[model samples]
Target: MALIGIISRELGNLTFLVSLDLGSNKFHGNLPQEMANLHRLKVLDLSFNSFSGEVPSWFGFLHQLQALNLGNNSFTGSIPSSFYNMPKLETLNLKFNSIEGQIPKVIGSLINLRVLNLIGNKLVGFIPTSLSNASRLETLEISYN
Candidate 1:
């Protein structure tokens, strides 16, 4: 059977973790805030699960995060502004969720970002012009909102 239930707070004990992919599983519930302790994390994929609640803003603390995939889940609420603080972030995927509100202009601050996918959300408003500031951005998919 697929892994199910909330992630344990004990996961934060792995301070040396570099990558964690719990995607395409049946796991549900809010992400444990304790995960903020994973200071060395680089890749985190929690897609295609039943996870519900506002996307955690503490993700900004993961300074080493390069790729983040929280797509195909049940998250709701506007995109967290803290996400713009992750300087090393390259890929951000939040497709097929219940996220709402306009894409913040601060998103352009992720100078190293390469791929950004936001398809199938409840977002509204024109794509921000400041997105042009992300000079390194290569792929942008924001259709089907």
Candidate 2:
């Protein structure tokens, strides 16, 4: 069974943490804002959970993050523009959620991104052409909108 309940700020104190896999859990409620304290986090996978509320803008504080998977959750609201703050971000998976609104143009600024998945959401508006700026992009999935 998946672990349930809100995450704790104690996790943020693990300053040396490079990767965190909390996917496939029963965890619910808004993500801990203190997660922004994980400065060295490189890969954060919190997919396949019950997490709700807007993806926190403080996530931008994790500058070293590379791959982030928050797919298959109950998260709502538009993707935060602050996401662009992570210049080293490579894979971004926010598929299978209730998130809406246009794909932010700032996404193109994530030049290091290799995989981009936003499938199965309520998003509207034309796909941003600036995505072309992501020279390293190998896979772009936006199906099942």
Q: What does each candidate score in C-alpha RMSD?
A: 0.9, 0.9
For model 1, the stretches where C-alpha displacement exceeds 4 angstroms are none
TM-score per model over all chains: 0.97, 0.97
For candidate 1, give the lDDT of residue 51.
92
- Note the residue pairs that clash in candidate 2: none
Model 2: lDDT of residue 127: 84
CA error at residue 124 for candidate 1, angstroms: 0.5
Clash count, candidate 1: 0
For model 1, how does the per-residue alpha-carbon lDDT over 4-70 read when each residue is reduced to its tens digit? 8999999999999999999989999999999999999999999999999999999989989999999
